[model samples]
Target: MARQPALSASLQPTLGAHRRLMAGLIPEAGFHAAPLDGVTFMRADANTTPAPVLQEPSIVLLGQGLKRSYLDGEVLAYAPGEILVVALPMQFDCDTVVQPGQPMLALSVRIDMAVVAELACQMDPLPPLPPGAPSAHARGLSVAPMDAALADALTRLLEVLGDAEASRVLGPQLLRELHYRVLQGPAGTGLRALAASQGRLGRVFRSIEQMRADPARELSVAALARDAGMSVSAFHEAFKRVTGHAPLQYLKLTRLHLARSWMLDHDLGAAEAAYRVGYGSASQFSREFKRLFGLPPSAARSQPVVPA
Candidate 1:
């Protein structure tokens, strides 16, 4: 018989210390030389309160204490040995319960669908997608345990980031290794579905990319359907099936999200931010911004963004 797999142990303090150091390296709200294009580290000390912000496609790993992410009326919690995978864009709030001395530290890796697909191609085939496999709606998020192997791999990757030349040379390889580990976990199938070509999730991703490229361009269901190579009705059904929202609604959300980020990162005024995101009317942009985020553009920008 195959030797029984060893039981995973509690997350040790050493990992926490490494995470603390990694958190110190991340710059505030700007790009830095991260090991991967989509990875960022976070450090916070608090309990129950979270800074509100929009979620993106990424994986969050807690190396110390516990935290919670709320979206779509659902509250998802993760502790030291667990991972959270978020595949769609949405408004989310998260906070930690770790106090002053022992703060909550976490790492986030943005998922690149292209990389995920390539890794899937190289791996052994997974059990065929379940009959009526899980839908790929905008509500695409999952939480699962962080195994020892994965934890160690993440720790090593962070350490590599401390060395400038080594990070430049081997960063991409280590990032791929991290993706492979996620593909081997329970969230694997969910990620594989998103990366699959011609699948509903994949089609949605392509459509979203198109919208992002030209948000101001008028988007019609029929036009998108033609581009997706599906009938209008089929496209509508599949779009909703994969994203939990109608195609038009999805586009609007995308526009608003980009607008918010623009205002926050570029210090753009309401009118300018609106115009940049393809909105012609400043009032219209403000109204939508207030509706989605519970604050108008100027006020929202003044609020603190949750750290990466």
Candidate 2:
């Protein structure tokens, strides 16, 4: 096989430091929360079967091994020295496979929209995105090369994980720096679009919030468009631009995710979970759940909920 492309030279040094820090910080299996709030370290010593999961908006950095995530039929693979930015909450499937001795090591930082908005304001203005450019709604997930500045900032953040005082005093600043670095990178435009409250992306996000508030409510494309103050045609285009899914499709997935949460968190049976999340028919819920998750409700209930 041809040799895989290497990380940029500017990024290599910090990537090495990140690997060492994570290896020392998380020496065993399972997800470990760091001293800093919203920061978590994960390690898996052996390969894992593909599993269904709920992922919130966050930044994921891989320091060792590899992993893959599937969302709406799109498969995204991440290796070392790359960063995965999820700009919204979505349910998806993930698989992480490790060699006999090498573990899959990763760092996850949950996004704080407030912080993201604040950081975006302080950064230099982003260039206008070209027509047909990928936006925050184009699935809300993006993978970008980890540049030297981001790598260094991440390394610094991880280094402070072992010191309580340092984490307390410097953690917030370092976290802000990391977010700033991301806003300055290639993916910055999408993130900025997501944070701009008066922008089209923001309107769609509000519509999403309405659906999340009541997933089972009788909703229509026209109603959602009216609420967003857009014509149906404009709403459809903008919504698809940001989320990569039509409004109705987004609602269906949201409902399924809600039902899954009920089953996993409250131990609700399939029928009860379905009704709780606004499904009127258990059979219909079961069919859709299996179609998206590759398992019937009964089987999905037995699987452990992976931390996002």
Candidate 3:
């Protein structure tokens, strides 16, 4: 019997363009685009070591090789014709499985909730959301096979980068189209869940933003519950249900991760970083940081920062 084909014709050209885009973006040793506020593309010759505290939500698609991301004790893997959706700030890891001759090349589009909100308003309302769909305690991570429409949109978006004039003129349009297409594809559910008003994940996402903005503020269960418009008990239950961690646990993790980023990117000492993240005791911060990351704060700071 003949082997089945791996990719549909509809997906081939777009994926081809993605492979080429990676080739250009990481022409030298792979580097990340500056963090959190923009797009970044990567191509790696070896598997990467994982990090303990990672934040930011982005879409991941591989053009040439394989990649893996971890969350909540689960390892999510993707490769050609696949996608990963990270919809919240969480600690995770990524590894490129492509070998020497076949480097892993992937594109990451950071999700701006603002952009997602804008696009969602423009989108035709989805059919009634699935029952138990807007779950708050679900993991904010998901993976899916890349379908043709999304692939084509991605291809067109990447092609825009080649023509500087066109990029300026058409970049936003292409980006919008890409987001729309993803929402229409299988990998879109997680995003849709986050975008839908009155949805559990949507509520959780709002609380997440609040917690991120003020990690040190004493957050009352009642206040956060009111923010989500759920009763105190409901809010607490949904928060853990959607994010795979208790609300306070999530806050602590987010703080620890942000502190790590600050230490690596700035001249801040461990104590300073801890204080910034709202920890009153430097020793307590060090203990938790070590437990989570397997390295003491100072030692982790001395290690080179990994380009995300």
Q: How well is each residue in 1-308 modelled by candidate 3, as lDDT tens digits?
A: 11112777777777777888767755655656622236676767766677553647878777787766666577776777887777776556555566667677777787766777777778776677567665322567777777877877778767766566877787777777777777776567668767765467778889988988887777777888997889988988888766667888888888888888888889789999899889999999999998877789989766544433
TM-score of each: 0.80, 0.86, 0.85
Relative to the true structure, candidate 1 reaches a TM of 0.80
The count of residue-pair clashes in candidate 1 stands at: 3
> lDDT tens digits, residues 18-126, model 1?
5666666653423343655677767665554665556778788765667777654676777766778776554456666775666666778888778888988887866
Question: Model 3: how far is 233 from its true place, Å?
Answer: 4.3
Cα lDDT of model 3 overall?
Answer: 0.73
lDDT of 2 by residue, 148-256 (tens): 8888898889888889899999999999888888878865556777887647767877898899888879899999999999999999987776666788988888888
For residue 182, give model 3's deviation from the true position in Å: 1.2
Candidates sorted by lDDT, descending order?
A: 2, 3, 1
Worst 10 residues of 1 by lDDT: 1-10
Q: What is the number of residue pairs that collide in model 2? A: 3
Pairs of residues clashing in candidate 1: 136-242, 137-242, 138-243
